[model samples]
Target: MIYYQWGYYLTKQQILDLYKTWGGKFGRFNPHDLTDIFHARRSIFHYLMPGPVRVWIAGNDAGDGVLFFVGKPNCPIRESVEPDLAERCLAMFGGPPCPFTLVPNTGGEAYIMKRKGKLYKMDLIQFMQSDTKGDQYPLSLDEILPEQMHLLGL
Candidate 1:
């Protein structure tokens, strides 16, 4: 069971707003998404996030945190978040608009392509360490009580 966390620097309020608007439902790739090279490779990439919301204190106690959810809602698969930590992670884009993308298994881990056909990739470790302000590790399920796991639909 592979799970992914799409990292984003969003406020706590913004997170709540997203839940209210999207009903906690995250996004999946659509046909139009293929134009983006990063998204074009995988049709079901978003399904990788199936764990609880992983949060890391970033710059402040509240309002700022490196937060993201796991897999898709009602996902039948279950896996400890530990292995994902050891697995490859997401990378921040150098340009504006889309700031992040999943680091591919081979080649450069970070990528950016210009409208004019230019493309680039960056070091995965450096990006995660510096761009994120600090390393953000995945949250583990072992700490959660078995009875409460269902609340997260895990």
Candidate 2:
């Protein structure tokens, strides 16, 4: 099975605010029921009440805050839910920044970033694999935006 996961990195306060605002709407089991899950300094994953689309929030290794949202490939949630949530977060918390996705089993990876008020999408593996240099693959992530670097856990 192929799974597509993507999210934005956020600050701790932002995560908390998100939980407070949207947690209740997640259906049946309140993610808040898990005591201290959000408060912990380390990474944590809180699986929200499941439905047609599965959603969860987890702290990134960087520990700045958390990486949120993940959905299956071709899931309508990507078009319907993700953009709306991203826009809301961007308006409320300053960014819907560094949106990225890694599709397991498919070698698919990409990130969307804002530069000079314009958004650009870059396909990492594709760029790295490009034959621009006589079979010499790109040796670094230097070409990638700073916000996008974290997607590789760098």
Candidate 3:
């Protein structure tokens, strides 16, 4: 099955570094140290599998991002999602149907939300850096913009 996993706050350099370290073989989507927020809870499944893996990453003009991981069929990391989980993610982020939209942070939590024609993200880093919270978390799409010009080298 195909597991579509999404991520945020990661730079292209970091991904390339991981790709090189892993010898182009995809493995667990371990959260990065700099990952201030955005949690993909399903990532736990990745630890249960071991094999050659494929991973794809994407991001918006902001620093927010997405990742697509295809695991071996019947494996723990393979595509497996529950309707209830999807519902909770959608309700919290308020976007179109997504396979995964959670991102991890330091101590707190954060997520991405879309409204009108714009896309915005909330992250714990923002809170620490700017002392923002709740509705304020969704207020700054510009707050978390990355200095990197590209994402996942694309």
How many steric overlaps are in each model, in order? 5, 0, 7
TM-score per candidate, in order?
Answer: 0.24, 0.30, 0.23
- Give the C-alpha lDDT of model 3: 0.33
What is the model-wide C-alpha lDDT for candidate 1?
0.31
Cα deviation at 86, candidate 1, in Å, is 20
Select the stronger candidate by lDDT from 1 and 3: 3
Which lDDT tens digits does candidate 3 get at residues 1-154? 3322332233444443434343432223343522322222113113212322222234445553333222222333223334443344334334333223334442323445333455555442322111112122232333233543242343
lDDT of model number 2: 0.37
Q: Give the TM-score of candidate 3.
A: 0.23
lDDT of each: 0.31, 0.37, 0.33
Compare the candidates by TM-score and give the number of the best one: 2
TM-score, model 1 to reference: 0.24
RMSD of 1: 15.7
Ranking by TM-score: 2, 1, 3
Question: Of the candidates numbered 2 and 3, which has the greater lDDT value?
Answer: 2
lDDT of 2 by residue, 30-69 (tens): 3343223233211112222121222123333333334444
RMSD of 3: 17.2
Stretches of candidate 3 off by over 4 Å are: 1-10, 24-57, 61-66, 69-154
